[model samples]
Target: MKFDKDAWLLEAIRIKYIIPREDGTVWRRKWISADLKSMSREVHLIKQRTHKATQRVYFNLTFKGITKSVLVNRVIALAFLPNPLKLPQVNHIDGDKSHNYLKQPTPELVEKWGEYQLEWSTGRDNEKHAHANGLKTGRGSQNSNAKLTAPQVVEIRASAESPSAIAKQYGVARSTIVNILEGKTWIHV
Candidate 1:
């Protein structure tokens, strides 16, 4: 059976949201409870920071004496959105990683924006969304790290020349040429 993370989260954590103040900053308050009623403690938001590599906002939370770093987007999704399909990834519909609130839109907001900001998605859907939003540069020429253009990859694949000869001509590693010929990389092109 598939493990239900939301169900486990509901039993493990009770999250409470504080209304935004005049400055328009929403405050998220987490209440750790031993039982649903009596024993509880409030803790300040800890180590919340934008990840330098992915540029996604995240924070560390302690659960059962173990500290885990979790993305703020996933936390917001877990708190406010429903994932009936149990998709393994949460996509930021607008491609803004810092905008982590997964609240439903008001009628006025819907009329203006037309869609929710977050949704459950498969890994492929998430990748597609990122590429569609220009957040990800896909394989081949579109990728910043791509050494060869699509036409060059095609030429390399069609060439009967040795991998070393092709690599020297393209100024890339022999393994790169070999991989291209072997259909290991640049499969999209």
Candidate 2:
């Protein structure tokens, strides 16, 4: 089926149909045949599957003998609105991928998602958002890869041994020792 002046269904790309946008729910459309004469324009809400690794809902679309897994969020966003920034990222407005295509996408929701979500961000904007949301935790003892605890960082700071010696004794990198001493990595100690 040809897209109705909306580019919602690109005949060249093998997109058969696009579901109507709704609030707080995901919708699906059926794939259409390439031959216009034999076209079966069956439109329905598709049931998507969540990827085990990414925890994001996706659907498989076959085009030109290649099956491509498309993310639900991106499909919904592209269907309902035009991306002004032309940035190749789709972010959930409420930080929930399960909330995909539940409501009509507004410019305000897109703007808010771009401003607040990190993975959808284009650059340092994500970092600023994380900091603002108190989600920037890769520092001091809060760092998941940290080998030493806060008390150990304090002890290391007050130690008389050289950085290299402290690093060897604590099984940490020499840079960790140097940064702790110079108040670069563990300033909280």
Candidate 3:
């Protein structure tokens, strides 16, 4: 089936936990345990909050006596859009993970918002898009684990030392030295 290029698509089994409406509101599906005598299946709107560690909005639901936390974006995708192609991931068009909802969009509004806010994508495609849009960091000297600073990379490039000697001097791998010399890792320098 053909869907709007920017439409939200559901993650697998999303319907079992939450319903994302076009209005951008997510409803938690009430789950019932077969063995429990007093379980009700009435769905209710979910109260979302930022996860402390990840700072992403999420809600929790109980299913078969077990509570599961679900991300808001995943809930939204599962509520709208068809996935005949069965792509495995969702892309936020503007690259903002926080823009998952806007005052509860109607299906029409959801489709419209999606035109500028959502798409189905693979993890690789999502990462490439993030990098292209400068939303992702950790490149070059900006990486927390970087052993060399930008100035050091520039000096390494300009140095006349052999790759092996530079590797020893910098306490880096020999391949790193080779890459620096060949304009591979530190291309910006």
Best by TM-score: 1
Model 3 score (lDDT): 0.65
Instruction: Give the winner by lDDT: 2 or 3.
Output: 3
lDDT of 2 by residue, 77-133 (tens): 555555677665665546565767545266786675543321344444544444444
Candidate 3: tens digits of C-alpha lDDT, residues 17-80:
4457665567654654555444346878878888776666777755444456766776666566
**Ranking by lDDT, best first?**
1, 3, 2
How much is the lDDT of residue 159 in candidate 1? 94
**What is the overall TM-score of model 1 with all chains considered together?**
0.58
| C-alpha-based local distance difference test score of model 2 | 0.59
Global lDDT of each model?
0.66, 0.59, 0.65
| lDDT: worst 10-residue window of model 3 | 3-12
Question: What TM-score goes with each of the models?
Answer: 0.58, 0.51, 0.55
Clashes of 1: 0
lDDT of 1 by residue, 131-171 (tens): 65667776678977888887888888889999999999999
lDDT score, candidate 1 = 0.66
Model 3 spans > 4 angstroms off: 1-18, 29-43, 102-116, 144-189
Candidates 1 and 3 compared: the better one by TM-score is 1
